[model samples]
Target: MSTETKEKYEKYYVPEQSPWPIVGAIGLFLLAFGGGNFIQQTTGKYGNEGSWGWLIFLVGLSIILYMMWSWWRDTVRESMGGLYSSQMDRSFRQGMLWFITSEVMFFAAFFGGLFYARTMVMPWLGGEGNNAMTHALLWPEFIPSWPMVETPAGDTTTAMGAFGLPAINTAILLTSSWTLTIAHHALIKGNRNTLINYTVITALLGVIFLCLQAYEYYEAYHHMGLTLGSGIYGSTFFMLTGFHGLHVTIGTIFLIVLSIRCASGHFKPENHFAFEAGAWYWHFVDVVWLFLFIFVYIL
Candidate 1:
């Protein structure tokens, strides 16, 4: 290309081949396999042992953490080195948007299942409409309910209420979202100290939310008898909340890393896509939790 042509068109920086993608894929496979085994073992589904499952799961988790740190570190280095251009920034934003869209679809599937179970399966089993014969052959005494606490095989459990821990968690997440917004505003206004303070607070709020969720799970398993084996209700409940908790954990780590970078004098007012991406993710998480609170808990 001619010098003038080359000068007119900015070149995108293409990094060397990286090993993180395959490493991340392997880690995800291990995590999914081990997690499946662990669930089966805990529920006595296939007589599998839980210990090995836990081990593999933790190993996978560690590998994933390492992969994320290394990959993100490289990205940060590239960003700080001024290798990224406006086109690259747009690419990053688009990537994050698509990522969040995938996440939305993921949660939508779960919510769809919940809807199908409630509207179709539960009512059919309860002998509603023309399904009386089907109900007789299946679960004769099954009652159509919003929170089905009894299994067909006579396993009974309590439904979680929206008044306690769930409500508190909702408040916590909302507050964190507000704090994060403040932090973002502060960053834009060049108020570094306020930015750091609110960001830290948001991270702490996420940790607190996770801790409370853990306690809620403990209570569910122990006191309420609400377990993975407690029929479709239990399965759906745990699946929705557990996956959401995992997202919160990841978002918390995202915020924590951003905060650390902030403290290290990274991210400027004009060029801070990393911070913006993190905020976008956290806001998405908060919205998902709101839906969970409403449909899964209150309604």
Candidate 2:
């Protein structure tokens, strides 16, 4: 082997096989199964008698959380001890990039479902295609529109227009993206104070955006009477936007962690993979929100 490869193998610290991943998988399986049972119970279908699924789900969730915390703590300790070389840093960067790319594709699947439902399914239900009798027998008054004011089931809801808190959130997220870019630039310039200030500001903006989103959800649920059970429109709206909100929450936590690292002088000007990872995640969240604002809310 080459000298560099030999050195890499020498420095690598691979752990023995651990049971955490398999245990975590079992926990997730319980969570999913229990959640399904819980939903059925809520709908007045007493499929499972004692809420055993929910209890199991909660236990599984706790185990998963513990696993993640312990695993990440160990990884951070290893990273801080100078165990990671340049090749390791590159691997981490590439791994994070590909992880974000996978997230993009995940959201893209939802977007695609939305498009297919709006352009094809709704139209076909309204007798636009080969199902003329479908309209005549079922939803004669249904109109195929993007916001889907009236569903085939005769349920109606006012579309959330783009002129309210959503537009404000768009501006907030966009400006935060700019501030985070400035923070990244400051970090590269070795201005730790400026970097911390900008990162803190960006994190605050993320908090504000999350607050605004919570308010928007309240408005939709109470004032607009648009909820996850409203219809297909409501379902799509909540699914896409809810997942994006969750990603924003995660990204904010990532930035907060990076800010703490910066304050502790953990990242140098030359080697700051943790900071870069957080920044890249934040940027990815920003881009996803931009698309959501344009397609889901605005259009």
Candidate 3:
């Protein structure tokens, strides 16, 4: 009986070893180092052109994008060939869950730094704690306040208004999330036309959000004097929202690919783990943007 069950049910399918993980690590290292230097140069801190930094960063990004496309294409082929069993699906779901959990922790660290800077660090530097000597010795005239536009070095820049472009971007992301939800339902109901249309609309919304963000950045740098060197406020503002924008870009690409797959009849009504995973990621991106809008923008 056991032999018969084993033969009928088929054994688990393990994937072959791949070199993408190491390649991806190398890409990330280059991206981090190059991107940091690129920022410094572009913000006038280094007074250099940042040509090499930009080149290395672009190369790293291209490699990462290529690896992702190739890896996902192979996975899609294997999935379409019916190589994945129920157990494999469960494993994929668990993997996605853990990945999202790690992403949450990643953002938590940034948020923690922001909170520490605002509540504890600034106050201590302003003579609020027992270290009056420290405050007087460093910046005796410093008065810690929200929307800190003045740095301790006497440098000043403008703080962006929360209700202008940021509010509009928030609305755009929220609508994209709704459109994606509709696309998910259409996929589940086997409405291919609606699925493709809604997914495309969602991707378009993501693009529009990015464009507005770009324009906002231009306004910050060109007119408002806000930049990477505009002190902690500008740094945190860009870091939080910049990473969110990158995630939105990735999500937009994911939706575009999923739309193409939908047109090619890749997902079925009941067995669409890939579609589910993309939807999960899109929704996560939406939620993160909401938090960013509230904490980084409105607050």
Candidate 4:
């Protein structure tokens, strides 16, 4: 082998096979099955004892959490011990980028659903195109409007106007993205303390955004009388916004992990796939929330 090839292969350190992935898969399976059962029970399609399903789902979630911590802990140990090579770093970067792209597609599906409901389905139902008689028979009072101020079933919710909390959250998320970027810069410059400080600030902003979102949901559901079961309008509203909230939750966890890694001196100025991966995921999340704010809340 050439000297370069020999060095590359020699430098790379692949760990032995581990059992965490399989355990994580089982945890996910349990969560999925239990969640399905719980939802069915909530909608009265299943027996009243669906609390068992929820209990099982929580157990699965706990298991998954434990698995993630253990698996990542092992990975971090290997990384800090200087086991990864340039090729390994490239692989990690590519994988994280692809994962973020998949998340983009996931959010895109929800956005597409919102657009179709507003522009096509509701309009067709209001006699805008070929279904006049059907429209008259179904919902004579149905009006097609963007932001969906009213539903055919008479459940009305004031659109979450974009002025107060939503706008504040937008600013918060945008600032968090900037803070994370600063942290990344600090990491690259080997400013460990500065990097840690910026990362913690970014994570705190994420927590603040989540808190605001919780209050927003409460205001929508309780005061505005808008709920998941309200109608198609409410269903689409909750589904799109709710899933985005879940993504935010995951991104927060990602940042928290990054902060811990940074504090532990796990990353260096030259090589830090773990830090980059967390930053990529966080930026992806920030972009998705921007779209949600504009399309779901503002527009």
Candidate 5:
């Protein structure tokens, strides 16, 4: 290589091959497989009567935790060692941008399915245009509806309302976003205690939100007859909110880590992309919940 190119390559910090990526992938796969099986068993799927799904899920979660600890340790060490340059900073920003973009698309697919079901599939099944004969011959009693409380097979469920727990959770998330912004501003001003305090509060708010949601789920299953198996409406409602809740859980952990790092005096006013990244992720999660509130709950 030319001397200039060789010098440029050497100037940028690139770590050696890491095992963490593969480890994380395995962890994610196991989490998905086990979680799916666990749900099936919970719902009384006969073949999984003696399944080890919950155990596998726990193992996967433990591996993921270990991977995060090790990976973050190495990255923090490298950063503290002054190995990353402006180029690396830009790379980090770009990587986060793309990651969030992919997440947007992931949720987009679910929203698309929701839209298609509501507008096209439901209408067609209810005797719209070309499917009139099919509807007449088949589901003649079926009603074109938004909530789809009754399944074609005769299972019924009550639709969750937009008020009460959902509205309270929305307020909590919005307030948490505001507090996180205040924390970011405090970090910029080098108010370490304020940063840590607000960050902890944000994480606590996330925990409360999860707790309330769990209660809501209990009410749905026991009183409202709403469940994962409760026809299309229940499935869509749970799928969207459940996935968003998982994101909130991850974002809460991210904020908690940032809080610990802030307490350790790990970031300076001018150099704190990790804090900014956590804020970005939290805001993204908050925005997704807004959409869920509008489309999945209110609508």
Candidate 6:
């Protein structure tokens, strides 16, 4: 190492300005606009816009995804080219920490709403607490029940059983967590082949889990007649499990990327922040699934 290189404290590399952020913002705007119109038109059936909203939504989604891929690809190239210093690495780690924290709070908001609706809103409608007048004025026949399968307006749907498909999905996720840990250990031991094999297995398990969830959704909609219109049960069920499934999808992609990078020898035993970050995210996704299994499904 050159003495001059070692002594250069002010050599922080600053990347040039990029237009990806603005592009991403435009993508988000289009998505929100199209999504709102699509939902309203589809659910209410009162709009002149039929399928154009959906097409616009897809375009926006594609744009956002392309932006993410390009931005991250450039960042990865920079890191691999050794343009990042120790300070930059710290910044990356901190950024990941804050991002994960934000995700946690996002899920917390949904769970909080779920609990409030289940515990308070339903109860108040069923003559509990000081809401007897509310019960009398609105939904006089509304019965307060945990898993309110029947709506106040007499709509009905079946509650999903916990021990059937959900149990299988839980097992699959747990196994994936184990396989990922094995891969991480193999990486630490410099066993590239084992790492790749186990990581691939983890990704496969994620795929299987998603397939099962999709089938479960089909069963709910087809045979069981459960949907967003079914009641609060369907709403919370989909809200919690649906978002978690999205996370699993993202985590599966993360694992696949890491597996490719591993095959190309992108990580070392001592310096693999990308791999560690992916592992942390996968584990967080797994933990959230566990909570959903217990509270959303079993309870």
Please list all clashing residue pairs in model 6, or write none if there are none.
none
- How does each model score on lDDT? 0.94, 0.82, 0.88, 0.83, 0.92, 0.87
Using all chains and alpha carbons, the TM-scores for the candidates as numbered come to 0.97, 0.86, 0.95, 0.90, 0.94, 0.92
lDDT of 6 by residue, 64-135 (tens): 888878887988898799898778778889999999999999899998998999888888889898889999
Judge candidate 3 at residue 212 and give its lDDT: 97
Candidate RMSDs in order:
1.2, 3.3, 1.6, 2.5, 2.4, 2.5
The lowest-lDDT stretch of 10 consecutive residues in candidate 1 is 42-51
Of 1 and 2, the candidate ahead on TM-score is 1
lDDT of 2 by residue, 20-92 (tens): 7787788778767876666455434365474676787688777766776676667778878888877777788
Candidate 5 is scored at a TM of 0.94
Candidate 4 residue-wise lDDT, 70-93, digit = tens: 998898888777788887888788
- Model 3 steric clash pairs: none
Question: Which ten-residue region of model 6 has the weakest summed lDDT?
Answer: 42-51
**Winner of 1 and 3 under TM-score:** 1
Error of 4 at 130 (Å): 1.0
Clashes of each: 0, 0, 0, 0, 0, 0
1-299 in candidate 3: lDDT tens per residue?
78878788756889999888898898888888889879978777767967589888998898889888988898999999989888899999999999889989988898898899999988988999697998999999989887789988788998898899999988998898899899889988989899989988988998898999999999999999888888899899888888888888888888888888888889998889888888899889889988888888778
- The deviation in Å at residue 267 for candidate 1 is 0.7
**Ten contiguous residues with the weakest lDDT in model 4:** 38-47
Report residue 164 deviation for candidate 2 (angstroms): 1.3
Q: Which 10-residue window in model 3 sums to the lowest lDDT? A: 42-51
Measure candidate 3: CA RMSD.
1.6
Residue 256, model 6: lDDT of 88
Query: Top TM-score: which candidate number?
Result: 1
In model 6, what lDDT does residue 212 have? 99
lDDT of 1 at 186: 93
